[model samples]
Target: MPGVEREPEGAGSARRSLAALLLSMGVSAAFAVAFIVVVGLDPGITFALLAALLVSAASAYRVLFGSPRRAGGITVGRTVMAGALATLVVFGAIQAIPHGRDHTNPPVVSEPAWDSPRTRELAAAACFLCHSNETRWPGYTNVAPVSWALTDHILTARDTFNFSAWEEFPTSARLIEAAIRDGRMPPWNFRLLHPEARLSAAEKEELIAGIRATLGG
Candidate 1:
């Protein structure tokens, strides 16, 4: 009888809590949408709202039921082993791919001048900041959705112009100069974070000179 009497009030309390939670979620979603809009991020407000909801749910769960403390040694060991295995698998797959047909036989420019030390260094200093397999500043680059964008951009840029395989492309010195001068290459947003990649007036002149020298212009 005592338990039965408490059931009705318990149900009412649960309903009230759910209503409050939902209201709070709604307000949080609205705020996220507004913030994303103000920031001018692509994909609009829905992405931000969803991200906020996920974070809120995680926080609520953690608060209601405390998270288990990690056994640091075991966790670190497991992570290191997983990373090593993944690296080996990736390396093996890359090595197994047909290098001749997939790489060597691809359409190439075949200009020795394109592979000159000056040209390679210039590409590394300027283009590789956002378009190479080797990334320099990579702390925030590993974080979730932002990492996704960075990875996609870098991969796409590399596919378009792989500096290591530049001799294969029908690239010309003029094309390179024009791409850099017009601010079409290296991308605007990428330059925002890597200001050193932003070509200075003097550096741009030097780059153009180097390209012209290579092309015998």
Candidate 2:
């Protein structure tokens, strides 16, 4: 016991490298989780991406910094496994939320009966996602965090306008035209994701004319 031999005072290269990996992963994961939580994101979607990111980062680190020995491999594997488990839990929790999985198009009660086929076509192409019963929910909407935000916007938009429920508004044509002219209807943020909603000057004018004629303002 008195003549015990010591290997070294400092950790080995492999141990040091493993420590670095864990430190990096921890920092990155903390930032990501904070961002997701702060934004009120659906953890399911955000965590899945976070898991993938962790795996990718580990792989990149191994490649760049040289592969770890058995201990390091075990460490990485355990971290990845933990990440996967976290993702699954988040996803399950998200599935239990209301309207979380209601990305399907609801039944149309009665769309505004358009007098002009051209106006109908234009509306279908540009405003359908938000202003109609027929919403083409994108693949991304199937995911949680994004789905939540996008679904909220669509619901709010429908509540505001809803060409399908045009009869209720009475002065729908004037309101719609004014909103479009001022570039406030489709909204700039919506247009960024949905380029089709971005109308040209001429297209806007034509759409206004068509709406006026159809609704008889």
Q: Deviation in angstroms for 154 in model 1?
A: 0.9
Off by over 4 Å in 1: 1-119, 215-217
lDDT (10s digit) by residue, model 2, range 1-217 = 5665765433464566586577657866785665464434556766665766566655654554455464444354545554455556655666566764687766676666677788888777778888877888767777765677677777777787677666553346898898888998676666777778888898888888988887778
Candidate 1 structure quality by residue, lDDT tens digits, 1-217: 6557456634554555465456556755664554344322345534653554555554543453345132211122333343344434443443443321211122223333542576657666778654444445456544333444455455566566654455543356677788988987767665666676777778777777877777665
Show model 2 residue runs off by greater than 4 Å.
1-98, 168-171
**Model 1's lDDT to the true fold?**
0.53
Model 2 clash pairs are none
The local distance difference test score of each candidate is 0.53, 0.68
Which 10 consecutive positions of candidate 1 have the poorest summed lDDT? Answer: 99-108
**What lDDT is reached at residue 192 by model 1?**
66
TM-score, cand. 1:
0.48
User: Residue 69 lDDT in model 1?
Assistant: 31
